[model samples]
Target: MLHLKDGLSFKPGLSDLGALASHYTVVFLLLTHTCGGQSDPQPMVAMAGDDVILPCHLETAADASDMTVAWTRPDLSPKFVHVRRDRMDFLINQNPLYQGRTSVFNSKLKRGDLSVKLYRVKLSDGGTYSCFIPDLDKESTVQLVVGQWILRSLDLFNAAF
Candidate 1:
């Protein structure tokens, strides 16, 4: 005897075995379809005051025009850095610290390029950033390392002298 959530109860018999197997197959297919994307975290190095791009893309080629893409820094205030929804960039809820400093490649959105460009990187910008696509339930992390530019310039000057 089996009881389903729909309040359906039935006794299993030899003829009912095929129907049971079919139900299991459908469940397995749905699970695989929903969990098809992959997330890969990458490390990025940048000089202070420089611009950098954080990469995130789907394994298979697919249009992401209708997907909701979000960039967040969990350790920072106003966690959201950049968010795109309904084919438009929404920043009303973005962190004030990141205002006017972040943007996505709009033309590339259709090609599944959810990467975000951050301008004028600061020392405080060195941290882990998460790129999430809610529709696919996929997300990836990117670690940013910001280096002091003045020190590097000084080293280069001394080496050339």
Candidate 2:
């Protein structure tokens, strides 16, 4: 038994699955739209001079150390942030800003862990980063909010002063 406002009600049964699903579909769309469609629960945050891991995963048991993993920032000119290929780091087209500050887990790549670690994070590092596996056509994104906590701390200090 399901009840809705405006005196509407339903006695859902096997035959009424279609109707129930239709109502659920409408509700799902409404909720998502109302939430502004931003599905990421929370953006990753890191302070200046800290290390942060921008997580990406393949969710497979296959070995991927030999596969090419492309980590890029779409807003950057060169775009390619860190790329691994042929069992070695390929930096031919990597962005200069990330030249010596990024790396992956060598031991975990066999399990499809494509996450990258950013060393000594800077405020300029705050942005959307993406990881893509071309051969598998799989990709994921991580939003980094760098130094936000520092900003909040400054705000508190100013208020106290």
Candidate 3:
């Protein structure tokens, strides 16, 4: 069983699968802070054929020019979407689908910008992404909402309100 900070617990294997399948998870944030990490809580919305920037930054605004920044989607195999190390892209392990479709603004790295731009968004791209700064021992997440799901989400939101 995995236990969360608020005392919520669940066994993560077989039994949990069906329960998860029956649920519609709206949004969730998990911040593993060893050194303060920050990310915009509002998801970045984009159409299926649009380019989008998933934003993340350090709460302390420390220089990240030479640090290792890893972007990954926990639910994907060979999860790496992008990885920057020593001020250059280290793409040897990037997922094939993301090849030639992601980039970081080198000019902004020095100011603690760890965001990545993803091009030609697809419906499969809708999910939570994890940003890890190994040097700072911090991690944060951002969500990408694609296409028609955005409209359905808004409808659900207004109904609840």
Candidate 4:
């Protein structure tokens, strides 16, 4: 027996495979309908040395005051880019590489916004970042691409010459 926060309950009988399959299909359809619609992650491209916002928000506009939000990059050392709990930012385990370079929109948290601002984007910063809300069991990812401004400028200058 499995219970979900949305008041959905289902029990799988080991003796009936067909019944289990039907139950799974029903659950899938119910979940898709209840979730409204799927929104693709917004892609972001930024130049080196520039600041960028990585956006993440709940499907439903609900207060996130008590939610635990975590931003992480699996490929980076000291994985945690930022973490917030009980409406407070925690940095004890934050990656030193991102020290003084990351922040969340505190004012918008109550509206379910968990966007993060990353300063001075570096080449190494181009990667996938996960925004997770543990209590809600919801997560989303944002893709970041970092480009060199100097190279782009030089290319434009050479083309003009």
Q: Best candidate, TM-score-wise?
A: 4
lDDT of 4 by residue, 1-161 (tens): 65444576656467544644433322110001111124633344457778888777888888887789999988988899999997789988898888889999887888888888989877777777888889988888776766663333333322332
Report the poorest 10 consecutive residues by lDDT, candidate 2.
27-36
lDDT (Cα, tens digit) per residue for candidate 3, span 65-158: 9999999998988999999998789999998989999999888887888888989887777777888989988787776656632234433432
Regions of model 2 farther than 4 Å from truth: 1-43, 148-161
Instruction: Compute the lDDT of residue 113 as modeled in candidate 4.
Output: 83
**lDDT digits (tens) for residues 1-161 of candidate 2:** 65544466666578667644433322100000001123554533446777877777776567898899999999998999899999899988999999999999999999878888889887788777888889888777776766533123333322332
For model 1 the local lDDT of residue 97 reads 85
- What's model 4's TM-score? 0.68
Backbone clash total, candidate 2: 0
lDDT of 2: 0.71
**Runs in model 3 lying further than 4 Å from the true structure:** 1-40, 148-161
Against the true structure, candidate 2 reaches a TM-score of: 0.66
Q: What would the TM-score be for candidate 1 when compared with the true structure?
A: 0.68
TM-score of each: 0.68, 0.66, 0.66, 0.68
lDDT for every model?
0.72, 0.71, 0.73, 0.71
